[model samples]
Target chain A: MLETHDTKLTEDSVRQLVREEIQRAFKKDPAKKQACIISSKGTLDWAYPPLILATAAAATGMDVSVFFTFYGLNVIHKDFERKLKVSPVGNPGMPMPVPMPDIVSSLPGMTSMATTMMKSKFANKHVASIRELLDVARESEVKLIACQMTMDVFGYTQDDFIDGVEFGGAAAFLSEARKSHLTLFI
Target chain B: MPDIKEDVVLDARNLLCPMPVVKAGKQIRTLEDGQILKILATDRGSIADFPAWADDTGNELLEWHEEDGTFVFFVRKVEEED
Candidate 1:
């Protein structure tokens, strides 16, 4: 038996519609005034993201903070020349100016050539340097926190880092992270 | 079209996002108390991004326009008293 009547929508359906409308009305929030970036890669390519993001966050007036843990400390260390090195042993896809095999890249002069080429390319395109980004981050008051446990394991003294570095443990990072709406692991 | 003088001109034509803002930030630091900076960018994101950046960083976006398919923005560096 079909009872023909205009079935009114229920309250739950209206509520659900309103809820979806509200959700859709909300915009994607930007990164917080504070951020925590965990740097673990010592390579030049892997280093750029953290620095770029940190500097950009600061430029956006966020209380940006980067926590250097493990290999991440190399980016902010005093002896970054030796601290940050790229090994071509396992890298099969690293671009070479010429078609050079893995053995050639492992040669003494090839890495330096590659590094120089990368730096020049970045400069030609007006990309900021790692050091420049670091400076901007520092100048903008971005807190550079060095992870203490990682430092102990890596045998890095407090003096091994540049100025404006704060040494902290995981708890310290967490405290900063709690207040931040933006937390990144790079 | 008459050449409207920009208080400052930041030529970020081929540069990327973070670089443009990063350089602009440095340039802004060097300007006088109420000087302005005009940024030219090819990165499409900069059109929207710079305004938010200006607001967040306490700068003021005075005016913006399109020129030769590039985005030109005029920002006044806020004299932050801290």
Candidate 2:
């Protein structure tokens, strides 16, 4: 096939390309405005994802909702400061800043120690704390929905959760999730 | 490059990832269409974060540069029509 160099390099064509680039840059779809998250894990480390993502999404003007199920209820529980702690004993491959025997990780109060260390590390890195993220979620009006089935199974009353936390079931979560363009499970 | 004059300037220095973006989102709302906002952030991540945020919000990221270890971003408000 013979090459044809018929296309001329016009200044207006170049300007049109730049204009299209800016227009494309400013295009935001309506679907990306909504986000739904399922927080099904209760570990201290696991808690970060849902809260961090929801708050960040909400900050970006997305209508964000988080549904907490099963053990994830601890995140919205009033006593999360005491109830939420990470244990390193069961996981042999858990990363620790220092090399330590598994025996040390299994000792009593080690979970709390690990939690304290993780909290400090996050603080030093200027990352928002779980509580601070929750506050941001609330301030940003991110919907925090607690699973009703889990509440009933665990015998937790509505008062067990913090203020502004809504009660909902799987159906309710799905209803919100379906409308959201971004759905995540953490 | 010519200095792009801004209508509003936000100092988001020393803030983390989402904080800067969140603050910028809120600030941009107060601006009218075609208005430009200048954000000064210390977080290196804002280099990418601002453009991503501007794209998500239907705003214009005119230009961004680094000065004295600070990431300065100029974002023009472009309201998304319903």
| Interface RMSD, in order shown | 2.0, 1.6
What ranges in model 1 sit over 4 Å off? A1-31, A87-89, B1-17, B26-37, B41-48, B51-70, B76-82
Candidate 1 residues A1-186, lDDT tens each? 113322656787668767877754532233345677777777777788988888887767677888888888889898775555555557767666577677767888766767777778888877777887888888888899999998999888999999999999899988878877888898
**Among all windows of ten consecutive residues in candidate 1 chain A, which has the lowest summed lDDT?**
A24-33
Highest-scoring model, lDDT? 2
Residue-level lDDT tens digits of model 2 in A101-137: 8798888888888888888887887877788888888
Clashes per candidate, residues 3 or more apart or on different chains: 2, 0
What TM-score would each prediction reach against the true structure?
Answer: 0.73, 0.84
For model 1 the local lDDT of residue A28 reads 29
Q: Worst ten-residue run, lDDT, model 2 chain B?
A: B17-26
- Scoring model 1 with DockQ, what do you get? 0.42
DockQ of each: 0.42, 0.50
